[model samples]
Target: MTDDLDTPVLDNHLHLDPRHGRGVDAVKDFVRLGGTHLLVVNKPSWHLGVEPDEPTDFRPVFEETLDAVAAANEVLPGRAWPVLGVHPGLISRLVDDRGFSPEDARDLMQGGIEVASEFVADGDALALKSGRPHYDVSDAVWAASNAVTRRAFELGAALDCAVQLHTEASEDLTDLAAAAEEVGLDPTRVVKHYAEGRLAGLTPSVMSEKDRLERAAESGEPFLMETDYVDDPEKPGMVLGPKTVPRRVRWLLEAGYDDAVRRAHVETPRAVYEIDTESTLNRDT
Candidate 1:
């Protein structure tokens, strides 16, 4: 694929896990395939099926992820950028031996407005997890996770980074007030990465595309549409694949929600939560 291909929408939720053996070459190939900016999001600790849930064979994927970004920068010059944060499902890793840090625990109790506002108020995007919308406890967690969620948010926001989440059916977030309250992260502080995408082995029903938009507007958060791909087709959507980006972009356009699609995966996200763009900028931790 070359840049001469379709008009590339901003690549919002492209996830590259070192565990998957993706290289900087793939990143350049994406840009060469017509992408303007490629936002490399956080992935599960390792490869699916072959790797354990958390990485036991290697160090945290974050470090390798940063290395890949460095390679991407070298390969594409100003294209590959980094987006850092913990996934809701992976929040377990962020917790100490006890659990989520006390601050995060408290934030989870309150609505996260004040707690999250304090952390990354200086950063880019406030990344948080809304779990699955259909789940009962997720609503409670959404109202709570905000405490420390924004610390990372501000860090990214200060750099104009976008918050991209890996959501599941049990992680439905169509209700703005309900979702924001449930996860405890400030909806206004970040853009959700995959509020409308389909999850594996789950029903296709969503919080109605129209209602999803209204929720985004009400929460003051930009919505993101992404292809959380897995390279092994045996895994399908587990990792962000090379073929999925444009295909999903076309899906959004055909739905006549191109503008919403663009903001979630492109414009707003790039302009806000991704300071890791361009290899030369190098902000990987």
Candidate 2:
């Protein structure tokens, strides 16, 4: 049903990894399903062996992400953008498997921040990504993770791009906003990715869960929605498919929450991530 709709929506977070063989099909399918824009993140590297050197060494992954954006634009110009950073889970893996000392890990993370900034500065990325206090990590690793996350926020301040945070669902985000402010980044620029509840006083990029989606819509709070679609063939549509957000919007529209759908699909994304929805959708048409 969403495939026939013309309403503009942005899937603010998704991974279009070639490793998974989704490639352009993923991007095309998303566009066909009424997704007018996307923010493609670097593929998580925890599955790869530990990266022990400077973030510049991660150039290939960042390049791949850019390539995905390029490919999407080729299919539908201005349809996609990139978000670059070292995944927080990869940080924990490096500490556990590679025996990277805390200081060394911090150094590596700083390198990542530098790399992310370069991409944003070059207009190749719209934001930086990182997470603090990843629950899967040990306390020591979590400390290192938070340090890296803070550095990312600092970079966001300098570069004037948003920072997408991968964090535990429903966690309090006041401290995160405070950290952003401390680093001179506007708290509104810090987006909590994969959020599942009402993140009072913070912005969230939410996923598709009917009850949670309903709750967020009813709250009349400003927020964005995402599928977090992994694009893995092994677990096809694992979190959600490309069409999920559009279908949700359809529900919102029918439920008399048209303004909520617009806020979530258009206004929040434009304000938080700087997407030009009008231009993107116009190009598609």
- 155-231 in candidate 1: lDDT tens per residue? 33443333444443434444532334344434443444544433222111122234444444344344444454444
Q: Which parts of model 2 have CA positions greater than 4 angstroms off?
A: 47-52, 283-285
lDDT of 2 by residue, 197-227 (tens): 4785468787877777888788788788888
Q: For each candidate, give its TM-score against the true structure.
A: 0.53, 0.93
User: After TM-score superposition, what is the CA distance of residue 39 in candidate 2 from its true location, in Å?
Assistant: 0.9
Tell me, by lDDT, which candidate is best: 2
Model 2, backbone clash pairs (residues 3+ apart or across chains), number: 0
Per-candidate Cα RMSD to the true structure, in Å, reads: 8.8, 2.0
Cα TM-score of candidate 1: 0.53
